[model samples]
Target: MKKLHVVAAIIKKDDKILATQRGYGEFKGLWEFPGGKIEKGESKKEALIREIKEELNADIKIDKFALDLEWQYPNFYLYMSCYECSLESDLKLLEHMNGKWLGKDELDSVQWIEADIKVVNYLKENL
Candidate 1:
C-alpha cells in the first residue's frame, strides 16, 4: 500500500477547536484538522505552518504534540502527526467547504474523516 505522511493542527481557542471540511477528493465534505502533507525534507511543524497558511491564510503557534496516528484505508495508509495549536491571526479561508470552531462537547458532533476521528477521540479522553 502507498503511504502518506501528514500533519494536522488541533487549533484551539479557549475550549474550542478548529475543524475544516474537505472541498475536494474522496474526503470531500468530511471534516478534519487544519494542516496537510509534509513536503520532503520539511519538518512536521514546518509543513503544518505552511499548510495552515495556504489553506486558511492564517498563522498558528503549535503548542504541543497531540497525537501520532496510523490508519489504513482501502487505497492508502495514513501516517499522521497532530499538534495542539493556537491561532495567531484572523482566518481567511481559501480552501475547504466549511469550517467550525467547536467546544469539546461538540467535538464529536461533526462528521470527521477517519484519521481525524482519532484526534477527536484523544480530545474526548484527555481534554
Candidate 2:
C-alpha cells in the first residue's frame, strides 16, 4: 500500500474547533480539520502553515502537537500529524465547501472523512 504523510491543524477559537467540508477530489463533502499533505523538504510545521494559508486563507499559531495517527484507506495508508492551533487572521474558504465551529460535545455531529474521525475522537477525549 502507498503511504501518505499529511499535517492537520486543529484550529481552536474559544471552545470550538474548525471543521471544513472538502470541496474537491475523492473526499468531497466529508468533514476534516483544515490542512493538507506535507511537501518535499518541508517540516511538518511549515507544511501545516502553508496548507492552512492555501486552503483557508488564514494564518495560524501552532500551539502543540496533538496526535500522530495512521489510518488505512482502501488505496493508501495515511499518516497524519495533528497540532493544536490558533487562527491569526480572518478565514476565507478557498478549498472547502463549508466550514463550522464545533465544540467538543459536537464533534460527532458531522460525517468526518474516515481518517479524520480518529482526530475527532482524540479531541473529544482530550478537549
Candidate 3:
C-alpha cells in the first residue's frame, strides 16, 4: 500500500484543541486536525505552517512535536505528525465547513476522520 505523510497542527488555545470539519471531497463534514500532505522536498514544519495558513488563514508558531501515528485506511497508510501550535489570529475556516475548540468532555461530539481519530485518542490519553 502507498503511504501518505501528513503534518497536522493540534492548535491549542486556553486548553481547547482546534478541530476543522472537511468541507469538500470524500471526507466532507468529518473533523480533522488542520493540515495537508507533505509535498516532496518540503520539511514537515514547513508543510504544516503552509497548510495551516492555506486552510485557516492564520499564522502559527509550532511549539513542540506532540504525537506521531500511523493508521491503515482502505486505500492507503497514513503517517501523521501532530504538533502543538499557537495561532496568531482568530481562525477563519476557509477550507472547512466549520471548526470548534474541543475539550476532553466535548471530544466525542465531533465526527473525526479515521486517521485523525487515532490522534484524538492519543491526545485524550496524553493531555
Candidate 4:
C-alpha cells in the first residue's frame, strides 16, 4: 500500500474548532480539519501554513503539536500529524464548499471523513 504523509490543523477559536467540508475528490461533503499533504523537503509546519493559505486564504500560528496517527484506507495508508493552530486572519473558503465552527459538544453532529474521525475522538476527550 502507498503511504501518504499529511498534516491537519485543528484551528481553535474561543471554544470552537473549524471544520471544513470537502468539495472535491472521493470524499466530497465530508468534514475535516483543514490541512494537506507534506511536500518533500518541507517541514510539517511549513506545509500546513502553505496549505491553509492556499485553501482558506488565511494565516495561522501553529500553537503546538496535537496528535499523530496512522490510518489505513483501501488505497493508501495515511500518516497524519495534527497540530493545534490559532487563526491570524479571516478565512475565505477557496477549496472547501462549506465550513462550520463546532464546539466540543457538537463535533459529532457532522459526518467527518474516516481519517478525521480519530482526530475528532481525540478532541472529544481533550477539549
Clashes of each: 0, 0, 0, 0
Which stretches in model 1 have alpha-carbon errors above 4 Å?
none
Q: Rate residue 117 of model 1 by lDDT.
A: 87
Candidate 4 global TM-score: 0.98
Q: Go through the candidates in order and give each one's C-alpha lDDT.
A: 0.92, 0.95, 0.91, 0.96
Per-residue lDDT of candidate 4, residues 16-113 (tens digit):
99999999998898999999999999999999999999999999999999999899999999999999999999999999999999999999999999
Poorest stretch of ten by lDDT in candidate 2: 118-127
* TM per prediction: 0.97, 0.98, 0.95, 0.98
Tell me how far the alpha carbon of residue 125 in candidate 1 is from the true structure, in angstroms, after superposition: 1.4
- For model 4, the superposed segments whose C-alpha errors exceed 4 Å read none
Ordered list by TM-score, greatest first: 4, 2, 1, 3
Q: Cα RMSDs of all predictions? A: 0.7, 0.7, 1.0, 0.6
Task: Report the candidate with higher TM-score, 1 versus 2.
Answer: 2
Best by lDDT: 4
lDDT of 4 at 11: 98
> Under the 3 Å rule for N, CA and C atoms, how many clashes does model 3 have?
0
Report the C-alpha lDDT of model 2 over 39-98, residue by residue, as the tens digit: 999999999999999999999999999999999989999999999999999999999999
At residue 46, give the lDDT of candidate 3. 98
Cα error of candidate 3 at position 52, Å:
0.2
Q: Using lDDT as the measure, what is the rank order of every candidate, best first?
A: 4, 2, 1, 3
